[model samples]
Target chain A: MSKQKTEHRKMLNATQGLKNVMGRHFLAIEQAYRDGKPTAWATSGSPVELLYAMDIQPILPENSATISAAQKYSRDFIEIAEAEGFSYDLCSYFKTNVGAVISNADLTKGGTGKPTFMLSTDVICDTHVNWFEVQAERLKVPHYTLDIPHVVSNTNNRQYNYFKKYIAEQLYSFLDFIQEVTGNEYNEERAKQVTQNSWDLSMVWQDIYELRKAVPCPMSTRDTFGGLFPLFTMPGLKEPIKLYKRMYREAKTRVDNGIGALEKEEFRLMFEGIPFWYNLKFFGMLERWNSIIVYEPYTYAFSKYMNPKVTKEMVLSQPIEAMSELMLSFWYIYDLKTRIKKFEETVREWKIDGVLLHENLSCRPNSCGLYDLKRHLMDDYDIPCLVISSDMNDPRKMNETQVINQIESFIEILRKRKKK
Target chain B: MQKIGIFDSGVETPEEIVMAAGFTPYRFFGDPTLQPDRANEHIPPTHCIWTRNLLEQAIKGLDENIVGIIGTHGCDRTNREFDIWIECLNLDFMFFLNSPRKRDNLALNFFINDLKELILRLEEVFNIEITPGKLKDAIIITNKIRKLLKDISDYRKKLVLKGSEFHELVKNAQYQDKNQVLENLEKKSEELKSRAPFSEKNIKKILLTGSEIDDTEFIKYLESLGFHIVIDDLGVGTKYFWNLVDENLEPIEALAKYHLTKPINSIKYPSYERFNVLQKLIEDYKVDGVINIAQKFCEPVLYDHPYLNKKFKELEIPYLFIEATYNRESYNQLSTRFSAFAEII
Candidate 1:
């Protein structure tokens, strides 16, 4: 019997800076826990700027789950949750967080201690509320669900103001909930500063994405997946801005120097769903075949707020409404037609050769309508799409050898089509 | 009369509003027997089977008389299906309603405004006025059906009729016109009240909770295993008519209040409220044990499983979790699990 060796690539220089930033984040969480400062464990998509303004340390359990999966400890944590009655088919991210919590694992192990409160948002999906509610009930802490109504249609903008107001009102209620939990007065000045920082950071994030369009793309999907940590966890603070600014400079330099994430960039591919956290190295296999994933909707989705064109002054003047707008601007929350149009735009702009759709079994919101997307891409846009079935955080669902064979076959098809 | 299609689990599409708009509100429950080829093109196999079935039915043409369809932000699967239908289904009209997850004044206010917007859209699309008087009359007719259904719900305690029989009748009512359904329910409630009560001694009165089990035959099979489901927290069953809309308030406000204040569903937030409602039902029904059966890939119910398991244990209630799908093989699979579960309890 022969075993295939897993190859690791040194992708980017900015990776070291991300590690430093994440290490500091972990230490700060630990310090907050030890000092008895109020901390709130939140969903990755929730409005954490409010928590920061209120002096409450915000901990993102989703990012922590990603960290655990990358470290190869997610399967153990997942089994712990299943043994405690979480179904095997539920979102692995939620289960991993629950398992880590039940075992009293801390920040170092991709978990956080019992916090003063928990917060969730329906901006991404209804699963966030469901997952957080359970943790809040078990820990006997106050939980708040910020519901952002889905803008399901492009022509449904007649109710745009109402949607904005609905979310704004919920933001006020969330503020009250935070105040009650921490006994901290709502600080307007601090909120303004934080909102400004977040808006500024997103602009820089967009610039970084633009830089990925260079010939011989300077960053791979694997690098961006890790680089997105601080953007998701601490975007409301100033430190991420400095780090992101540094990353932008680094990518710009790479682009100017004609450097790439791979030795030879053959095909520019796009990824549609969440990457397999357990097997991020799988991306390296594509690189070995001289195919580099230049764009990912999952990563670009975090910066969709730039589309609606909100100025920094607007964000500072009405921080709550700004937060509401940011939560509501996710492109995935809209109609399938709109999403496909956006996907088509990216395929054209990035000059994509093929599309890879990860049909993650555990995430319905992200995986649901992907089959149609594949049809649209192939039939309408003339772009080849390959769907690889797996779970984002559950390695048990993946057959690596089978996936490798499928990718190799897909790349062969793309090569043939390119020759044609 | 023209028809307006509705989805299960969310109360945003009040039958009264659809009726006031001069349309029959026909709820869609995906069939468990049909194989889906076209729906698989739009939705993956990993989604809720109930949704896939619904999409299959829609593609097959729901009804020539279906003037429009009303979709709601019910769950993630159904929520996205709203978009898919708009793109795929060539219906004349479609409307999506956004329901609030939290039960508070602000949420209520938001929901009321949303309902008002829906009413306006219905009126504009049909080119007819939905007068307040028509809304009140529609509310009265729908409320009568709910009251009769509640009355008939009591007959389950006697074990006179099988749980599947009652659910089948209610499921059929959703497809019929309101007046016809109300009349049939009134007659059925009267007939059940006069029937002789059963004296079965050893039947386990089970409380079924979770997402909608579109197939009542599954319930029948459980009953065949000596476990009789006397009550349920299913969206299509009791929760559909659990609360009546207030007649005194303005129609839109009443609709908003009823939806937000009704028995919390699985997808709602602070999931403890759902457990609280189930706890009360367990006590009221004298439930021997709970069979938590949810559709495969139904995130709301799956996410609540661990917390619910803990709550049931703390309350010393015998609980079993079952993952159900629309496939015949899954039904057969459940039989063995049900048999062992029935024997253990």
Candidate 2:
């Protein structure tokens, strides 16, 4: 029995290390909050590098909501929010956070306390604009929004040039607002350093996701989902950099050793839209069927920051332009053509056998037109796609039996196709 | 000649550009009569009904006279469907006018540049020039229609027209050509002012706030229940005609300012602006209550629901929230809620 335990330990990879780091990070945040350190609630896609440069703690309610969902506590929080007139149709993440705040659920173990201020951007989705506004009002904190216009054309077009200028000016204004709230000067040098770190961190994440292209896929979908915490929470921090480095190293080793996440890998698949955070174990069940989700577009969406070649020198010299370009390049912020192009490239690169699209009921921007995208993929790329309707945070919206049945049937179809 | 259809949501594209390019500018306000079945093929079933209805219309080529369609960013639904529209519909010209959510200088400049880009694209597509003279003329026609509509709204506030009549008049104004709409509104304004005022005794004056509602049956039914909708903050009703483009400024700049600084809506940031607008509407219209007819999955309005409730509570104003679907099958539920709200007020 002791020898078996030792072998199991050897098989355990950086995912366990990642879990430990995340736990420690949350503990540190709780300690900071208890110490009355300055903290603010920030949107996941907001310009968080500025917060790092200013030495202000940034809390992401979405991240907390996701954690609560994974822990199966989102339903309680969601009910609380729904009781407060937040409809069940609203983003479950928003509902969960609002419910937790009103009910004092403390899903973050005191890590996410009352914020000093709130900040959000309109880059990824309008939900951020609405969600942060409601939170700021409820918490009685000053809220600031960065209105990053959508990129309507190609990057080289004149419209994009105007958009870049607009975003740069808004970034300066955002900096000014942050300075007023935090009583700190805009640290250009520190911001440049943070931006460089962000670029490096994003590159590592890109490599970590790209390494899954190996046959039998080095990492499982569940591990990748767990690995997203650092990227979402500590973008410019060294912790995520270290975490991803370890993950990449382990993934490479697994690839070399021909050790896939599943004992008998048969099918490689891609996931679309946000995962049902409450039922992420369902993804592990795929491993039972010898099927692995090698790619999820959500993880690769963060790779947008690594492109266009952002350097430390450019970050310092043209800080606003650099930041504006980074914000503008967010995958979800772009048009359908770009989204389709990226998905196609990922499908080709990962050699995806099938696709599982989540028709998340709560997210409009992410979930809308997914059926159309699926049809396009089927018709143009000859890729088989199946859509499952569920909410990422709200457990009530998901039927475990139904989801498992659909997934099983989908896998059966894929297997039959392979046999044919 | 095929017309260029302009979809709603405060589109900033100067309608004059299309007109000068020799294509008539037809505003598609979405047919409430259209079913959501066709649109569900392209968009999810849970999307905003107005978007779905419009997409259904586009899918069926309901108006074969339309050669192109222009979309604007007012909400998530509108913004996300732009690509789908181009791919799903057979149109030679398609463009989405990107607008910022704030009324700051930077946002205005971005809007102005965006309008300019739209003009350049229109020129390239239709092989026509959008001279300053043509733009000014377009602005003149649009402003005239706006002034007439404002007069009509003011008359409705004075109780010269009933809520149902006001809605019908606005609906007609939305679908007609600018010249015809202006001419009809001018004639109706004079006729309404000459009529006797509506009796205010024992009648509850309420304000309606929400997205575009093409089916006035529910609203008309509310009126039959003894509630008077004295003012509206709906996208299609008041928000569309409340502000006019400045005829004195540069055509593009005026259009940009008009689009940017218009009465606040749910999609805009800083809920305080929208709250302030509602507060002023409540006081100015002497509204006894507010009925927020929000769409079920509409995130922007749902997010603003709590804020609206808080403000109404502080103001000691009675308010009711009703979530509506495109099918309008839940009229009984709405009727019960409206009756209770009427009793409270």
Candidate 3:
């Protein structure tokens, strides 16, 4: 076999193994659900754990919102949120949240059934904590929102305190609710066994993010990222964890050799703002221009770190420490200063020539405050910056041709600067 | 020398920023009420509802007193989408911010540094000091206005006020005259405080989050539901006041302090200290529940809501989701959803 193909096969094998391990974890959870043993959701900052806490089988609005945004139905759903008293300029993610909730009008998480409750956290994003407030209020469901303080340095003390407090409270509450709803006592024996599976599932899933080590990326960024998809849907399930192991070992080798596929020596562009959904072609076309979008700073990137705060103290009356993607994502520690520094450093590190700031139509967060950032890039780095226009999910809001033309102009500026 | 004037976006005139700088701070509103030329029409046609609204507002009157204009990235549609104008239309200067929307000194330092950079470029290109003293004066003057306004708003919210009329105060407060505005506010506060507090019994306090839902009908709908939207995450409401200057600092230093200290509205930039702004709004208003309104194709909110929703769930505070559309025909359905959300909590 050729050197590239050999690498690819190794990557695939690793990913396949991880998936297998995750499968076992899922099987355990599914079996518990089928047996009607008892299940509950308590949340930490991570979606992975939240899935377990939310009972794993229920259609979570958080999971649904992101998927719906990617599906482009987020806007329609967001409109429902706005009508229900949400705001236009608040946050696009929240809008998609409305979209996810409204779009999933009837979607359930697990094939078995919708979970009994939703679990949440205020540690990651404030808008969402409130967004869940609206959801719980509307659903009239008894849910839990664990308030995690801002982990400025990503400390375990902070997370442990929060997790222990909320987990303890939630356990008592869950104990009461379970008795009232199912007339079951606090089933410690069953809960521990189930919680371990959930932890095993996350440990395996973490392998997916670590799987980018294969040269030419043995598996595609698509395959690697895709392997973790089950984490959202099948939290506490075995497949996600099982699938990650194979992928992990292959990635470990790749990382050892310093042979990852993101084209390590290229000018890594930190893409800001929403992609034109109408022009989902934006990604393809931009990539075609020799412009590599390093990270878009969405939830996709938010899932790249592990929680430093989960110290078995139990913040939400459940095993939040062992799960949840938020704590798992390195980006949770990603602050604006860090990001700006990263943007600058990455440009230096990745040999970036220019940055394409898509000033999205509806997302004020990414789109807002460009003059300052743009000015800094130009003055400090002497680099060219381009601020293009488009919507996050809808293309109807922009003129595609004009955008292309502007991008072309930006490319020219970048090339001109690069020549110097 | 012709000087360039940069200002934040939205409805209110940037007269204060302009006037205090000792140079004409032109109102560079993207809204059509102040149309300069067809600079933006090429990037996005006039058909876009937001573009059209901006053009209409700009056309009404964007003061052409300044030689150059600076726009914040916060204004979404018109600020960063200026390549069309810079390339095709030809303006003297157009600078956009690459600011991070979070309360951290780094961002503030970046902004002050950028302002200096902008000044340097403007000086090199247009020969303008927006100077240390002038910038300082601008900051001080701007602070005065903010303090005065904040005081009046606080006074209006004081529980013991008799027949307190905040709407009247908000309307009159926008007037350029500080003394007159203060006088009116004081008188209003006295009248309101003299009377007993309005019964909080049925008045549903709401925290609204979304786009520029400055429409009268939108506000009215909430009011009809017996909800008084006390605060919002809207640009015109919660977002604009997110940054503050640090004490024990020079005006320019203070300006820089705002960058790192401001609450981030963008989900693109990671802010673990998220919801600082929203939480403040909730506490200040004694908000019962929250309403997060998302615009048709916004991305930040898509990322923003989960964090907010997560918090609300933990707090057990009910929040509603409302998505916005330009399709006015859908108003009835929207109203029904609004009523349903309000009724839940």
Best by TM-score: 1
lDDT of 3 by residue, A1-420 (tens): 478764564235555454454445445556767777544332224344333433343343444444455565666766766665454545455566555555455322211123455555544444445455545554565555543322221123433344344334443554465456545554554456555555565565545433432223333433433354555555555555555565666656666766544333233454554455434545546545555553444423433334455433342334533333234234433433344555676466445567777776554434433544566677777757777766665434567788789877887776676677
- How does the DockQ of candidate 3 come out? 0.04
Off by over 4 Å in 3: A1-59, A69-114, A124-126, A147-242, A248-267, A272-282, A294-335, A348-374, A382-419, B1-345
DockQ value for model 2: 0.69
TM-score of 3: 0.47
Give the best candidate by lDDT.
1
lDDT of 2 by residue, B63-128 (tens): 777778778787766666887887787666788887778888888888888888888877877788
Interface RMSD, one decimal, each candidate: 1.5, 2.0, 13.3
Give the clashing pairs for model 2: none
Give the worst 10-residue stretch by lDDT in candidate 2 chain A. A4-13
Off by over 4 Å in 2: A1-12, A34-36, A107-111, A152-156, A306-317, B10-23, B199-201
**lDDT value, residue A105 of candidate 2:** 67
Q: Please provide, for model 3 over B1-345, each residue's C-alpha lDDT reduced to its tens digit, 9 standing for 90 to 100.
A: 233444443322233334444454433323212332443333333223444444344334444544665655443333334332232323566554433333333334445554454455456555545665666655555555455445545542454321124433443333234445556656654665556665666766777775455444556556766777665555444343434444347655666554444455543234324476677777877877888776554434544565577777898888776666534455566877777776886
Better of 2 and 3 by TM-score: 2
Task: Please give the range of 10 consecutive residues that has the lowest summed lDDT in model 1 chain A.
Answer: A1-10
What are the candidates' individual DockQ scores? 0.71, 0.69, 0.04
Candidate 1 accuracy as lDDT: 0.81
Which candidate number would show the highest DockQ if scored against the true structure? 1
